[model samples]
Target: MNPIEARHWISAEDKDLKTVSFFHLSFPEQRAAFEELIQHTPAIQVYDTIWQQLQELMKTRHPAEKLSPDLLQQKAAAHIGNGPADEYGVWVYYPWSQRLVHILDEAEFVEMRTSRNQHKITAAEIKTLAAKKIGIIGLSVGQSAALTLAIERLCGEIRIADFDTLDLSNLNRIRAGIHNIGLPKTTIVAREIAEIDPFLKVTCFEKGITEDNIEDFLQEGGRLDVLAEECDSMDIKILSRQRARAMGIPVVMETSDRGMMDIERFDQEPQRPLLHGKVPDDLSYTTIRQFSGEQRMQVALNILDYDNISEKLRSSIHEIGKTITTWPQLASAVALGGAMVAHVCREICLEHNIPSGRYYVDPDQLFKL
Candidate 1:
């Protein structure tokens, strides 16, 4: 397997890239010798891109003046951790591949990886995002949003909470394969983010948020910039909102029907009702916890606003514990949920007014006659 594609190793210690210098030959005779070495070991083919990249790095560092071949080689060596291939080369040992791969330093790696997001997110926005922390609870639909946020570099730090393990059934909307079965959703999501950018700080709560740990999760790292609440547990769903409101953290949630998304700016309106009054302030955590399956379904329906929910979802509500096992979700709706939450998060973090209200990302309405 390609070292990059080796999932287990990527999550392991070898995940860190080494600052390996590109092989530079100043003289024609040295070039011939290096070419001879490459011929002997085809394993060096991995460095071909790095070799080309070094030239570009040299040009960037000396934009105003033309650098001589020797000076370019010298600078490239220093920039990439100046040393001989085996001697000074930064190398990471991948146990899976049983190969030592040379890789870029963290700074260059992040620069090239995120270079494409420029101007749209803008340099200033990117810098601001790097200092922000985002928290996500429930890894099913929230997994989609977490990844979207990570891919866009919306925040430098992310706290993910989910106690459930990946089941075969979750493949429909949770974006995990059979290989991930039995693994905690938090682990899978954290590993995926690490693979995308190892420098990103991801803290996983293997156990879903509870009253015991909610305070630490929200305020442990100076309070979350935003909270995405998408858990199946009605108790957590409500409890998290309370914590978010108490901490003055904005909250966002997406329901997997009619593309319904809700954003509550607790920071702006601290007294706003949790879930817009659907979940009553008098509703005790103990009461929510002891609710029967049917009772929980009613609570969920109430929060989604029974009158405004899509007909399809309204119909499915009756099937729970009857004709079907649980609430139905489609990959399409889950992906849309991800997009909706990520967009709202960016706006809130950038100090924009997303407001406290429920909005539909209704695809049916958008494309209808």
Candidate 2:
């Protein structure tokens, strides 16, 4: 808008992107005026050396009108690490980070524009999905789920949580690759969603879900719109399914068994029992914690064991560990898994009641499912 601001823009005769500009308020500009306002405090000093040097940092004037400090302070109280604050007594935090605020607005813009394109999803049945929020616990398969839902425009919102980083080994199946190695999965996936649909609503929990923080991750507006169990922890699987059942959101999963679609619906209907309403009647999430070891076995059994039932040592491997250490490749053989889940999501989103179960295939004959 201003002459100096104009310098931040980049243009090309041939590119299709909408251009945006970045500016760090000059010392003589608004930032300096703001510094004169706040009485110099110890905490304010620490922000200079660290946050000031970070790429895309901002020093703003007055209170952030869009993001209330009361709200973010409450969020930080719940989310900040238990370590010590910096020299200035001010700790780096989110909801205040310029990048994060930009992402929330961007995700919403992308989602709204994409959703309004009724030409793509001509079905009215999808309206219900608009308010649906999915909690994705891990980022590998969860990344696939997020991309799937975003591309298809299946849901109204998404909530992502992961406590790990992008490891070099993850490049094989993760949406990210070598360049992203070591970044937190939630951060990486948040960026991916923003890139795909800037208007997508993503609330990222940088921490992994545990008994301690699960409620914080839920955000209180509603039970998850749905739950996708992507984490490999057998214990977490039991907890997620139990929580979903108690809250009344259906759960969907896409597994790679040489390209099989495993769709497990945990009741969205009222007064339903947990596990497709086929289990205990008085279920609280805690009530179902007893299901850990056995549920893992039953679930593994449901997924066809590639090597047939495991013999002695192999039994221990699958019973206590992994069989397919490496996920399947993304060739036609593997993509079949995504397609099957897509079919299942269409059914669930469109009000079709598919019997709850796992679907699969043998490596030699993919797509048979």
For candidate 1, report its TM-score. 0.79
Off by over 4 Å in 1: 1-49, 52-82, 85-102
Provide the global lDDT of candidate 1 against the true structure.
0.75
- List lDDT for all candidates, in order: 0.75, 0.51
The digit string of per-residue lDDT tens for model 1 on 1-369 reads 121222221122233321112232434453454456456654553322464456566666566988888888777777657444343322333221223344444566556556678767787888888888899999878999999999998998888888888989899998876887887787788767765665677877777889999897887867899999988888988888888888899999998788988988999999999888887887877898898977887898888899998888889878877898888999999999999899999999989768888888799999999
- For each candidate, what TM-score against the reference? 0.79, 0.56
Give lDDT tens digits, candidate 2, residues 322-368.
65543234434324554555456656766777766655555555433
> Model 1 — which ten-residue stretch has the worst lDDT?
1-10
User: How much is 10 displaced in model 1, in angstroms?
Assistant: 17
Residue 361 shift from truth in candidate 2, angstroms: 6.1
- Ten-residue region with minimum lDDT total, candidate 2: 6-15
